[model samples]
Target: MTSDAPAAADKRPRKADGDRLSKLARHKHIISQLTAAPTLRASELAAVLGVSGETIRRDLMELQEQKLINRTYGGASRPFALEPALTDRKAIMIAEREAMAAVIADLILPNEVLMLGAGATTFHIARRLASRAHDITVITHDYAIAAALAVNPSIRVLCCPGRYHPNEGYVFGTQTIANINSYEANRAIVSATGISARGANDADDEAGAIYGAMAKRAAEAILVADHSKFDQRALTVFAHWTDIDRLVTDRQPEGALATALRAAGTEIIVAQL
Candidate 1:
């Protein structure tokens, strides 16, 4: 207050420091990652943190623990449970996920038996199929996917039996695996919870495990995921690059992933959006 002394201004706490909800709001943001796919590049995420890459990784671990979202290579995303949170995720990625699925369906041939996995993207693809073709047997563990084909008598639809996750709109469990194993699919179109540099498809929970089981029984494995899934590892890995027949995505997957998948002998098809 003296002329010789520098006057100190009153200090207020940052909103992040003052509001308990500031913490909860942080939790809410990870759900945004689910919607921000294809555009959420890992390198860009590391840049946003203002910390070293390693620090951001540790931060992601804490988010993963809250079950707000699963950890990805450079980010975090909403968990698979059906909830208002998932609905939020769905709204953001609608155009991109739809584009990726459109690219995947372009390769389908008539009279092929296909196993569709659970995820909003898969549900979108099934809807497209319902309009375009008939006499194709679609096998799936997802109620939403099965229902999309319900009125189509020409397309034979098989539903797997197991525990149904109402949030994910899919059936998954040992019973689901048993049902999936009973039939052989010509090609299996599935989605992933995340993709790792190791070129593996990872899932957030046990539902992922059942999808992996059915994928192995198919003659060809075609993964239908958008660019957002790249550079992340989930709770369980369903298949490796060596196991995948093709990767159908909205954009070309980048980073260590493109090389790893190619080296593993997997063909990547970038869907034209």
Candidate 2:
């Protein structure tokens, strides 16, 4: 005896199922956004996802628990990952760094005293300066920079004394800061892990301290960062945009970052690579 039934009407879609699917979709969208940018504010994400801030917070908590992202103050950031070592970084963006180095080299005058920071881009700048016939005195905490300029008889390299960080190929500590303060330079050329409206940032605390001291003692402070660094946040904010005299980068900064740099009165130099 077959009874024609509609299989219980396909068991009407469950409310919980729809809610779970929606939450899953939201998680995916959040991950995609974070993958594109290093960090995103909770409020921004909430608006984009058309959800309440509270909902976003809960989602962030779950994502953090899953080791998908890191929860920051009022925001979420990509999961913590160690920055690449200097040797690896040296090859990452050669063309852009070279162009930036050339621009920076043009700014230096013969016999001017310079303070150079430790990083791949700064290393390139040191190389460019070394190639010039100009006689300059350079005070630096980077072993690579010192070595790069060593062959140039026209350039005098003064190495800052401190504890050496192997991966960074540089020296940093209290001694480094003290050494930086001992002499005031005409210009300080530095690099950063990130730059945003908040400030110029670094991944290492000790290195940040050295950079800060150098910027303070120098007559002019120049920051060399790439377009990739714009709007990014690092572990330590070493200098604000107002503290920098010039910002030399591979591309022009856009959006809030550009506005903030302008408001801070930092001269922006876009290197034509």
lDDT of 1 by residue, 132-219 (tens): 7768998888887899977677889988888878777777788888888899999888887677655555545576687677679899
* Residue 17, candidate 2: C-alpha displacement in angstroms: 20
**What are the lDDT scores of the predictions, listed in order?**
0.72, 0.86
Question: Candidate 1: which stretches are off by over 4 Å?
Answer: 1-85
* Distance from true location, Cα of 76 in model 1, Å: 14
Score residue 218 of candidate 2 by CA lDDT. Answer: 93
Question: What are the per-model numbers of colliding residue pairs?
Answer: 2, 0
Prediction 2 global C-alpha lDDT: 0.86
Angstrom error at residue 159, model 2: 0.8
Q: Say which candidate scores most in lDDT.
A: 2
Writing each residue's lDDT as its tens digit, candidate 2 over 54-121 gives 99899999999997889999999876433577778898989999999999989999899999999999
Which candidate ranks first by TM-score, i.e. highest? 2
